[model samples]
Target chain A: MDRPASFLDEALSLDDGDSNNLQPWIGRVVLVEDCVETNGAFVLHHLIKRFLSPNLSSSDSIVIFVAFAQPFSHYDRILLPLGDRQGEGVPSKEAKRDIGDMDWRDLVTGLELAWVGGLGFAELGCNLVVQRENKRLIFFDMLMLECPDDGVEDGIIALYGNIQKAVEAVSSLNKNITIMIDDISLLEVAANGSTKDVLDFMHYCHTLTTQFACTIITVIHEDIYSSADHFTLPLQMEHLADIKIKAEPLVTGLAADVHGQLTILNKGSSDGLGRWKSKIRNFHYRVKENSVEYFYPGGRT
Target chain B: MATNKGRTSSFSRNFSAAPTSSIPGLKYGPNGTIFLSSGVPDLDKILGGGFHLGSLVMIMEDTEAPHHMLLLRNFMSQGLVHNQPILYASPSTNPRAFLGTLPTMLVSKDDRSRNTDAEQKDLRIAWQYKKYLGENKPHIEERDGKVEYCNEFDLRKPIEKHLIMGNRVECISLLDCSSLAGFRNSCSKFLSQLPRYDGNITSAGRIAIQSLCAPQCEYFDKEWDMLSFIRSLKSMVRSSNAVAFLTFPASLVSPSVSKRWQHLADTLLSVKAIPDEDKELANLLTGYQDMLGLLSVHKVARFNTQVPVILDATTYSIKLQKRRSLVLECLNQAPVDGSSGSSYGTSGSCSGSSKTGTLDF
Candidate 1:
C-alpha cells in the first residue's frame, strides 16, 4: 500500500511509501531552530509521532526522547487522549475531539485542513506509554538536571553514557534508533552556559551517528544568540545539521488561522530513488490539541 | 479562526466540565491544571484563567516606575484573603513592613445596581445549585455562605490587621540572604510546607519575590548565579502546589539573561509606564488620561497541550475604576475619527505605546 505525502513530508523528503526498505532520515542530524515569539516544540512533537508511527518507518525502530524542557506527561498526552486511562503515569489527556481523519488531498489544496495532523498519530493513535512498555520508545526526564559549576562535563558525560547504553541495546536487535533532544538550549542552561562542555557532548553524539547509523534531531532558539557577536552555539548547531527547519512568528504577527510559519531548508537527502536535490520550502502551520495542521500561506480562507 | 471554534468550545467546557472541589481560592482549568487567582479580577479574565498552580509568573518591571508592585500587592492580598500560605521576599530590609500596605478586599460595590444583580443571582442558586456552582462562575457569591475565591481589592485601603496576623504570612529580607542560593534555600523551606497531591490539591500557596535582581541585592552582579537560581526555582515550583511571582527590571540585567528569564517563566508579562503627557497617544486612543500603564502578555502557560492560547488582544491599558480599585480595559480608538487601518502608522511614533491596544496584530 502506497500512502501519499503531505507538504511537510515532501519538504523534508521523507517517504511514507510501503516499498521503502531503508529509512531516508537515518544518520542525519536535523535541527529545528525557533524564536521566542513562536516555540518550535510543536515541530518536535510532530517528529516524535513521525518516528513512532509504523507507517513512516520500520516497526523495529526505537525513539530515544530526551526532554529537557517539559515532563513525560507533556509528551505522553500528545499521543492520544486516553482519558479513561488517565490513571496511568500521565496526568492530563489530549482533547479527543480533533482526531477526525482526513485525506491527503486536503494538504495539497491549501484548505484549512482540520485539526488533526492527518498522518501518523491521528489514525494509529500510538500511545507513548505503550511504545515505552514495548521497547519502541525511551524517555529521559531531565527537567530536574542542574549541573554544578565544576561537574558540568561530568553530568553531560553521564547523560551521553546512558544514551550510548540504550543505543547499544537497541542496535543488536536490528532496530533503527533516533535520538531526539527537545532542545539544546536548556542543555546549555543546565550546564550554566558552559559552551565547551555542551560542544563536547554534541561531538560525542555525532560520533554515535557514525558508529551505529542512528539519526539525531535537536532544537534550539535562534533568536537567543542573534545579537551575540560570536554566535558560537547556534552557529555551531547550524553547521552540524544536514537539514534545518526554522519556525518563526510571521513578520505581520500571529493569526487565528495560522500559528506560525515554518521554513524547511533540506540539504540533499538520499533515498531508495536517489539523493533529492537541496530544496527550500516555507509553509504555515496551526497547532491543535492532538496534532498540528500544515498549510501553505494564504491556503485557507 | 473558523476552524478553531470547536477547539475553543471544548476549551471552555473543560474548565467547568471537570468534577472539581469547591476550593475557596482554587478553580479547575483545562489540562488538569488548577488556577490560582493572580489577585486582580480583570487580570484573571485576561489570562483566560489566573496563574495555574505550580507556574512561575514573572513580571518584567518598568525601571522608571514601581508599577509591578500593583500586581505584587494584589497577589499577596488575595492569598491572605483566601488563607493560603504566603512567603514574600523583597530586597529591602523591612520586607515585613511592606505587608501592612497590602490592599484589602473591597466589600462595598460602588455600582449599586451591579451589587443587587449579583445578590439576586447567588440567592437564586442558594439552595438548589449551590453545591453544583461550577468553577466557571468565579465571583464573590454568598450562596451557602462559602468564602469567595477571588476578590476585588480597594487599592487605597490597607488590609485589616487581623487578616494579616491570622494567616501564615512569612516575609523575608533579601539582605538576609547573601546570595541567590541563600534566597533559594528560603524558598524551598517555605515551599516544603505546602506539598502537592496527585491530581488533588489541599491548598495553594503564593510566593511573591519583588525585584529579584534589583541593584541593592548582593547577588545583583552574579548574572549566571541568578539565572541558575531561577532555573532551579522553576523546577522546584513545578513540583509543588504553589505559584512563585517574581519581578525583575529587564533594563538592569543583560539582554541575554533577561531573555532566558522570559523563557523560564510559565506565564510571562511586561508592564511599561505610560508617559505623563503624550499628545500622540492622547489623540490615538480614548481613555488616555485614565491609563496608568500598559500590560502586554508575552506568554500564557500551556500545561499538557501543545496548542498556545493566542488572545484577540495582547496589550491592555491598566486603568483604575473611580480611582479606588484596579481595573484593566482594552484600549479602543477615539470616537473622534472614523479612520481606517492606514492611520495606525501616523499615530505610532513611540515604540512602547505604539501597539494598537485592541488590534490582534
Candidate 2:
C-alpha cells in the first residue's frame, strides 16, 4: 500500500534533484595555536556544541597536558603536597603521588589510550578535577600531575612526548578532540640555554598539529612576566595557526576591574569566519583566577 | 424739437446699454462673438479649434480621373491672413498648360439651393443605376469637363470671390509644372523664384503636387523607394515653415503604395467618389440621368488637432454621389476605419483619445 503523503513530502519533492546529493561538511579545519586563544579552544567549543552534540557527543572528547618547566630537578615536590600540615588531617594528594611514580614510557602509553582519567580517580572517577573553593583550579590540577622518577629535563621531554603521541593517535582515530595549552612561555624559559633547543621546541609544538586530525588550542597571556624577544617566543607556532584571536585588556574603573576584548583572524579554508567577519567586532571577558566570565557581545545563542 | 430729440436719444441709450465690468482691449474684445464663433463651425470642430498661426500642416489625396485642386487652394485661402504662402505642384496634370480643372463654384450657396430638387431626384437615379451595375461593374458615370478634356474653366474668379478678397496676397499658388514631360527644369526655376516673394506672399502659400510618381504608375513598380523621393521634397517645405500637400491617382496605385505614401505624409486623406446606388429607383428614369458626376468632397486627416477628427465625403451623403461613387466607397473601405459602427457616422469623426497623441494611423 502506498503511504499517504504529507505537506512536507510534497514541498521536498519540489526541490528533489540529484545535485543535492553532493553534501560538503560546512566546518573547516582551522589549525589553531598561539595568540590569546592559544589554540582553537573557542572554535572547538562551538563545534562540539553544534556537530558533536545530541548526534555524537559520546564519541567526542578533549585532552590537555599538565607539565612543568625543565631543569628544576625535584618533580616529586612539584607533584605532591609539600607542606606538612598533618595534624590538621589534610590529605596527601593522591594524583600527585601517582604521577610522580610514572616513568616516561608510562606517560607515552597513557597518551596512546583512548582516554586518561583526570587527577584523582580513587575517590571519584572525575574526568576533570576541580579543587573545592580554590580560585586557582588550573594550578591545583598542574600540581597534582607531576613526575617522580624523572629530572626536570626528563619530565619536560616526557610531557612533550605524551602530548605529541596523544595528538597523533587521536588524529588517526579521527576523534573530534580539541587540545588546550595554557601557556607557551614555560617552554621559552626551558630553552634559555640554547637557540637550537628553543627552535627545536618551537618547531615541535608548531608542527605537532600537522600530524593530528584533532584540533589544538593554546592560551597565552598578553603580559609574559619575563624577558623573551619576539623571535624566541612561540612566533613559529603563532604563524602556523589558521586562526588567531587576540585578547586585550578592557578596563573600566579602579579596584583591579578588567575585561578582555578579542580580535580574531580567520585563516582556514572551510571556516565560517568569512560570515562572522561582519558580525563579530569584539568580545568581553572578565577573568577571575583560573576561570573567566566570557561575554559575547551579540550573545552566542 | 428739443422733446423729440430727447425721446430719440433716450431710446438709443436704452438699446446700447454698457457692460457692468471693465473690459480690456477692443470693444467686446474678451467675450465677443468673434472669439466664440469658429470661422467654419463644422470645420473648426473637426480641426479641434480654428486654424492658428505658425502651424505646420500637410494634405494628401489620390486624384479621380479629373483633378480636384481647389480644396487645397481654398484651404490656403484662409491660411493667407497669417501671411502664409501657398505652393502648388501637379506632376500628373499640367496646371500651367491649362487653368484650374476643378470648378470652385460647384457647391456655392446659390448652386446648393438650385441643386436641392435636383439633389433628391439625382440620388434616386444613382441608387437604381448602382443596382443595375451590380457588384462587378466598374461603377461609372459621365466624365465630362474633366481636367484631361477641358481646355479652360475660369476657376480663379470664383476662388478670389469666395476665398481670397480679404486674405492677403501673402497667399501664393504655385501650379507645379514639374511632373509633366519636358517641364522639370522650368518648374525648378519657378520654385527658385519663391524665396524672392517670401514676404509679398502670405505664410499661407499652398503647393499641390499632381502625383507622387514622376511618370504615371511609377508607384506600382517600386513603392517604398518612390515614397521616399516624395518624402524628400518635404525638406524644402520645412525650410520655410510651409505645408506641402500631395495629390495622386486614386485607383492606379496598390495598397503598399498608399501605405508608403501615408508613412511619409504627416496628414493623409482620400477624396473618393460617392456611389449613386445609395439613393432611389424612379430617378434613374428621369431626364438628368448623369447628375452624379465629378464633384468631390474633401476627406481630411485630422492631426495635432484638439478633438481627434477626420472628414470625408460621408459628411454629406447626397453631396457624396456628385463625384465618382466607387472611389468614395473604396476610401470608406480603408482598413483604418474597419469594423466601425454607424453610431460614429461615416467620415469617421470618432473620438479615440486617452490623452493627446498622434492618431493611430
Which candidate number would show the highest lDDT if scored against the true structure? 1
User: B246-325, model 2: which lDDT tens digit per residue?
Assistant: 66654455543443344334344444333457432222212223333222323222221111122222222112233411
What is the alpha-carbon lDDT of model 2 when measured against the actual structure? 0.33
Q: Write one digit per residue (lDDT tens) for candidate 1, span A48-124.
A: 76676655336577899888888776676555531111122222232222223322211211121122223222333
Residue B142 accuracy (lDDT) in model 2: 12
The true-versus-predicted C-alpha distance at residue A37 of model 2, in Å, is: 80
Q: Stretches of candidate 1 above 4 Å error?
A: A1-5, A16-22, A81-124, A270-276, B1-21, B110-147, B337-361
Best by DockQ: 1
User: Can you write out model 1's per-residue Cα lDDT over B106-199, one digit (the tens) per residue?
Assistant: 8855465267447745644432253243232232222222136668888999999999999999988987778777778888988998855633
Which consecutive 10 residues in model 2 chain B have the weakest lDDT in total?
A: B26-35
In model 2, where do residues sit more than 4 Å from their true spots?
A1-301, B1-45, B49-70, B76-85, B97-202, B214-225, B279-344, B347-361
What's the TM-score of each model vs. the native?
0.84, 0.28
Query: Tens-digit lDDT track for model 2 on A220-265?
Result: 4333322345444435555655556665434431112223344555
Worst 10 residues of 2 chain A by lDDT: A1-10
